[model samples]
Target chain A: MSTLETAAQPEYLCRIAIDPLSRVEGHGKVTLFTDRDHHIRQARLHIVEFRGFEKFIQGRPYWEVPVVVQRLCGICPVSHNLAASKAVDQLVGAHEITPTAEKIRRLMHYGQTLQSHAVHFFHLASPDFLFEFDAEVARRNIGGVMADYPDVARQGVRLRKYGQEVIRVTAGKRVHGTGNVPGGVNKALTLQERNYLLADLDLMIQWGRNIVKLIKQAYALNPGYFSDFATIRSNYLSLVRADGALDLYHGGLRTKNDQGQILFDHLDYRRYAQVLREQVKPWSYMKFPFINSLGPDRGWYRVGPLARINNCDFIPTPLAEDERREFAALGEGQPVHLTLAYHWARMIELLHAAEAIHELLLDPDIFGDELVVRGEMAREGVGVIEAPRGTLFHHYRINEDGLIEKANLIVSTTNNNQAMNESIRQVAERYLDGKELTEPLLNQIEVAVRAYDPCLSCATHALGQMPLYVELVEAETGTVMDCLVRDADGTFRHSG
Target chain B: MSEEQSFTLDGRRVPFQAGQTIMAAALAAGVYIPHLCFNREFAPHGSCRVCLVGVNGRMQAACTTPAAAGQTVESETGEIREIRRGILQMLFVEGNHVCPACEKSGACQLQAVAYYVGMLAPHYTHFYPRRPVDASHPEAVIDFNRCILCELCVRASRDVDGKNVFAVQGRGIEAHLVVNTPSGKLGATDFSIHDKAAQVCPTGAILTKHRGYEIPIGQRLYDRKPISVVGDVATLSESKGGRRHD
Candidate 1:
């Protein structure tokens, strides 16, 4: 009986959860568990809500879906509009689209990425850099940046406003733009509109350069600043054009392992099951999208900033490439294994996108005519675009009557399941000493998770408005942890 | 419809769809109907009678009129045009709409449609009422003096947003948009100019608070283009500030 009793036993199950994780576009949570050796046993990331846009879009006309989907997120509405319209265009299968329309479409995509990426950094990510992560939530906003370095804040606003103007001039509205269509863009950019944008664009060019310099100066001043977050190497994925350029809208998929070896390139999307697998866990609503051949039990992969940096063959823009090379110098390796390095990588991508935009605007077709695709709506198709967070995949199957029959939205956050899980574990393993956890350190882990800007509400719950409230419960006693909250300026603010 | 319909709008016989509004059928039939508050953007609320059409009997909002498949729809007739003019006259009379001084004058949907229907003179006495202007939002303005009470903003806030940031408080003509989220300003609430509900005003009621002088009048909406210009707009993020609130 004593011999039969001998067995491998489970040890401590460390559970962690952070509701309303800071630094992300929307609300989210991260949970992880570990044994006594600090070995990660399990990790789950739950984005607990969905607005059911796909189901609601059932009977609405296809053209209206882009506009409706644009309302899904105030942060990156134009990206949704572009992806939806592109999907509708593919289904229509019109080959008659003129070059001028293509020019406008590319310009719009550039404009959307420009504004969204700008907001992602200037408005969202910079807070952690400018203010202490442990600082009071009330004072850790744009005002925080203003108080510490007003010049940076002012420059950010100038840069951000300039990028948004491109959207305003072309999309008519920035957030919920609708000027794009399946056949082509709705209108041509007038000479006058172009001139209006040119002045601000000139200002942005100066500001963008200054931003790179500031980041470089900060890095030089603190050489070891990145070592703390480095070494989170995971299999990375991104979209690159036929020439392996960093293409935002039109591109084929590129997936690579941590060794910088090209595992796959331009794989047909219809056979996506061959490359990706979703392992559903009971703890989290989000599905773990592991590299299919990587095996099921073998988990942990990263996406968004870190993944994009790892997967890319080379930086496209000249200036961005230099900065990217400098970034690689911090950790001399093929795939830098640092999660914190994601911020620097993201800034490089932003610089690249801005430079590419200026080049695209110079194309003569952008100012020409020939819009609209001639076709009847009676087909189904897919449109994949790069959201500010990651690659956003939208698949729709419409009926002959031109109504949506089914919709599958694999958003930016959904694609990076393995990566996020790995990042959480890595952070936990590194930060959580063999000691009781403090509130601020836990929140730092939360901020680290949200650097991807995962829009979980857009990921799941495709039926109605998703409302998720994460509560802290006492494990044995089943008592609620007191969460003190007060209404501050019509929004919930917490002070302990 | 099973019902045989024939209608003469501007001396043309147009078959009207059963249960379809006169404006809806006319729009489907390629007739250019002018209206300020009536946008297909939302279901017809009938707050603006700019789409006033002469039915078989009395004047009606073409957007709200039901075409019974057999009904005659007089859309472009002189009498209907004259009614539209009077509605504009009353709309202008009820508020302070100084076109020469207004920012939305050239690009304003109201002024453009009014010009299309020939509302040359107000032909009515001005109300000369003093209304509150909310300049609380650093990026948007709510000028009650320029509001036409078309309920576009109200409906946008209540119906679309599911957030009642804006409401028509008080009774009768005294009804005005009340901001219940403190300080009577949009910025005070979770509201920002980016919300669809906030920026969809038909008249000069709610105006873009910033970047007015950035783009000259010659390049603004309607003055240089049409609503169909939706496809031509480019998406540029460099110079924009994301809405103050997500």
Candidate 2:
């Protein structure tokens, strides 16, 4: 009999696991399986918890949907806030909101993107990039980054603080603000608040440029290493303005295939159900979303920073446009599929956000008194926005009494599930070996997953405490052989 | 009642009337005991448990426990604070407390109490329990999902409004507030927006109609200051009982 067929043998079983994956917003685990010969067979990323938000929201008032769903993720509440607001706006029968309301919503969205992207780059992903992934666990962290490159670390902190300040000044607080409403925002920006944000524009713009410059320097240090790391070619999706310029707040849905060919463009988001559908996998609480034309397997597409940068023809702002061109060049006349490119694209978007904020602040309409537009009620509506991570879809159906009958939310990370798995497999094949399971090898898997900056919290509507444990197990007996425990602060040590 | 008595509250000698509970004495003396469902206008209902305080090295609900002379009452102590946070966590998990989406968020006593007690994250498992929202009332809505079972509405409806329109119907986790009407609908009852019961909800469970965001969130009662400073102010300000658009 073939050794691979020997299922009863305990020693022949092989599994590698990274539980409660670190640095991400919420709980997730990675499990790698190999055959008896130790040939890697499959690698799967499992979302362990489910919040059942869709099921629980059944009888909630439609007006409350926006505010309630924002609780899904403290890291990206504004995305859910605005997405739910847009969906309810349709239900309220206001096809277009007032000019002032639109500007305020746009401002909030930009603030969210800037803050979320900053936290990911500085707090979550930068440690792996700045310190080599193989560096000592203690020395490879924000503290280490601070000790070695104090200026860069300081800038990152200051930049994130500035983004948070924008959110606080505009939305009432840094997280779970009650500023957004169904037809528009609750209130307009006062001149004092506007001036407060505008005063920091110069410093923020400079810091954004410095961040892009710093990323370029890091890329220069190891051009070939990042260029070929965890690369996966797939279809990309995002929102674009009518002229095909990048738009985060309101626009038509656009998607491109791996060859940089536009699969579709300028499609109405309200008609999303006709062209898009989600397929649930038993392995994950998160659903895999794909274009209806391509079916589940072939239809899988990528979303978030790299996807947005790739799918958009141009950015509206000049500084970000320049960076966009430079980024596009790295694709070698095609789409850039290197997972590491997400970090670089994120910086470019950050610059665009600062520029966009500056532009919005300059407009006098931002100070208008007209904040909300109450319209006739409708039964159903859909809202879509390009969240910091990617395009987010919130669809709701309400009864005559204005209570939610159903709610289906396709968060940013759900769209990337297939691509994330593919990237993990590619990473596993490159670094995971039966001979050894080192921390750096595990970090390689982490780096690949971190590229997407997946917020499993939002993706799965998850909350509560999770145990962070890594295990090397025997698949036959389902027994843990060796384990590593990760503390809440992201430090790891051998548990067994 | 006899002469006035005083207790050491968080190291401050706060004087109280003989008949007053620790929560009432604290509020009367300008000291805040963070609470929900214990309105100054109504009798004490310690159903929320957010006002738990350390008294003589033992935990007790400040709203229900009478202030004793010379007794050491610790409301702001770490152990007391942790207990309050645990109560808040339980309320958060037991019901659908989506603060971001609720109309009463900034003005909500439960939300403000949560903030005051430093319950930064809902550190417990979310029940995500499927609850009902009753929008049958034209001038008000009752979202049972946000109910913390404080019984303020039931007390106000029964005693203050003289309507007897609401009551607690079930027990344990299944315990819930129910409408007292032939059709079991708020719309079918004489529950008006002007009812005292409608204005007494600590959470968004009972909200006035068409007044969502009447005042922008930042300028709301609790938003203007921490709940510690705005204690009972959200309820006391409603004595005037009229909406003002800021």
Candidate 3:
């Protein structure tokens, strides 16, 4: 059966769509097909925006690729920055960057991960979870959280702000900082800036623990609902250290089968194209990435937080290691297929990030001055990093004249595209009925998608205003039956 | 110098010598006027129009309009700011000012000016013009795609560098920065990397070879402070060739 056909249910003849999916990064929609009998036939998540960063970077100078390609996603610029920089580092034949440069880059990566995850948890996903998913539309934003739980909201803002501050200090400015260069980074952390960030580490750690406890409590309060909602089984993929420990900044790529057995271990990222392949579907602009050996049917694997936690054997940090033990227990010797567990896993990573930052700060190398190493230039190279969302890859081929001949970027979100569709389908199958399309039903579908904290902007490389809305269209006649619109600021209204 | 008469600029007292334009007067008085294509070392060519100011409720180029005594000039007002922002947007779309990839990013007057005026989003449609990059020169490269048609290179080459190797060719929207050689290549001309034209580019149009990202990014000239306090285009245009040999 074809990929789109996998969601087939002959009984359904109508469509239920969550257009311009809200609380996500960019523009997307979830379309569910059902018959007159109210049984879901098929469901697919369609990424609406299409940006071709891969094509245009060609012909530009090789040194410019790192900077040019980072424009792919504003929210995750540091991911692109480091990925592109690492790719160029290969082109320059710099196999090992100086210690200071590596540490500084690692610091910046952690900052990006911390801030991005904080925003996803507090500003985006927490709203749904905090307000019980079916809360009034108007009181379901950051403002609403501020009014209800002012202290928790303040902690979120403060933690996210600290992450931004760390990024700003290490990268020059918070957004689109030009710190990462071809060979390595362009600057090092100053003593003053280090002290400033050092001052916040304690508070950030405390807040990270508090938030983790809150999420843990939430999971405990409704374990069954959280675990079963939109749940699906898929393979897991992430980068692991030599000992199979969680290493987001630098590590070897690893993949495990759905049963949690290692499929590939310590494989070089340059050979990623060999193990992974992209399958395009006509319905969505986003491509489906699957394991090359398994093919499309069972090759689809999960990435980001849950996958990272599942694939890694251990977390090096003390508190995160404890949380990892608990998280692992959820799977009971196998990979956790619970979709809502992604949020819990994200918090664990957040705690790990806080601990990692403290370790990096104490390292004397982070304050050193040898940031870049000049070297012989090569024709081709690839760089990969575990972004806040998932593993991001940037590969480039340059001509002898130092101009880029070809470029290909695999953003983190694209890896989860197929799995996201599968999760949406699971939600639709569970709650969606053709008898009546209700707001709560529409929101449940959204909650499933949001659990991934997918950055659609990075996934599709979108431009222009991204509006979120859901429509129920008759599959037979392609006519709209019901529609819900979500404005830019997270305000929901039933338009039709 | 006619007693160096003072004029009201953005409600601040700025004194100017005879024959100085509003931009020069503001620069000297430590006040910033957002501009491109207007340099103090050479004659002011108000071609970029990014520094258009309101004088007595009339729009005029700050680089060419002389500072008159007791004249009310508004440079930072809402209307003038909007006009400057619009002009910057037009310049952005006119050429591909890829700041992230450009060598002159942190030190580029264009980027700094854009930041100063708070031009966050490019509201207008992007032309995404397909311009060419001339890398024929061994020591210098000219990326026409980043040129804002400021003519700073043209003037610097003719006036200060005395190379006459650069010129603005064509007219109106179709105009472009061109090398004087018959082949229109920097390598075909005698323009040295040390030429003032090479140093005076407000954007990353003209860059010296092997010196790309040499100064790094954060610790670069303009990274520490705003362009207004970092000596504007005049001080930035001055050669600082003693740092490293490329």
Order the candidates by TM-score, highest first: 3, 2, 1
At residue A376, give the lDDT of candidate 3. 80
Report clash pairs, candidate 2.
A67-B101
Per-residue lDDT of model 3, residues A115-159, tens digit only? 888988888778877887678766776778889999988988888
Model 3, runs deviating above 4 Å: A1-12, A433-435, A459-469, A475-480, A483-496, B1-93, B98-102, B111-128, B136-138, B155-164, B180-183, B187-191, B209-229, B232-246
**DockQ of predicted candidate 3:** 0.33
* DockQ of each candidate, alpha-carbon based: 0.03, 0.38, 0.33
Evaluate model 2 with DockQ and give the value: 0.38
**lDDT per model vs. reference:** 0.64, 0.81, 0.81
Instruction: Score residue A237 of candidate 3 by CA lDDT.
Output: 89
- Tell me which residue pairs clash in candidate 3: A12-A34, A12-A35, A13-A34, A13-A35, A14-A475, A19-A469, A19-A470, A20-A468, A38-A434
Off by over 4 Å in 2: A1-13, A433-435, A459-470, A474-496, B1-102, B109-131, B145-177, B194-197, B200-203, B210-214, B225-246
Write one digit per residue (lDDT tens) for candidate 3, span B113-158.
8888878777888999988777677777678888887787788888
Task: Predict model 1's lDDT versus the native.
Answer: 0.64
Best candidate (score: TM-score) = 3
Which of the two, 1 or 3, has more TM-score? 3
Mind giving the per-residue lDDT tens digits that candidate 2 earns over B91-155? 89999886656677667778878888899889999989877778888778888878888888888
Stretches of candidate 1 off by over 4 Å are: A1-17, A31-43, A95-97, A135-138, A220-225, A270-274, A296-301, A329-333, A375-378, A458-473, A480-496, B1-246
Interface RMSD of 1: 15.9
Q: Report how far off residue A138 is in candidate 3 (Å).
A: 4.0
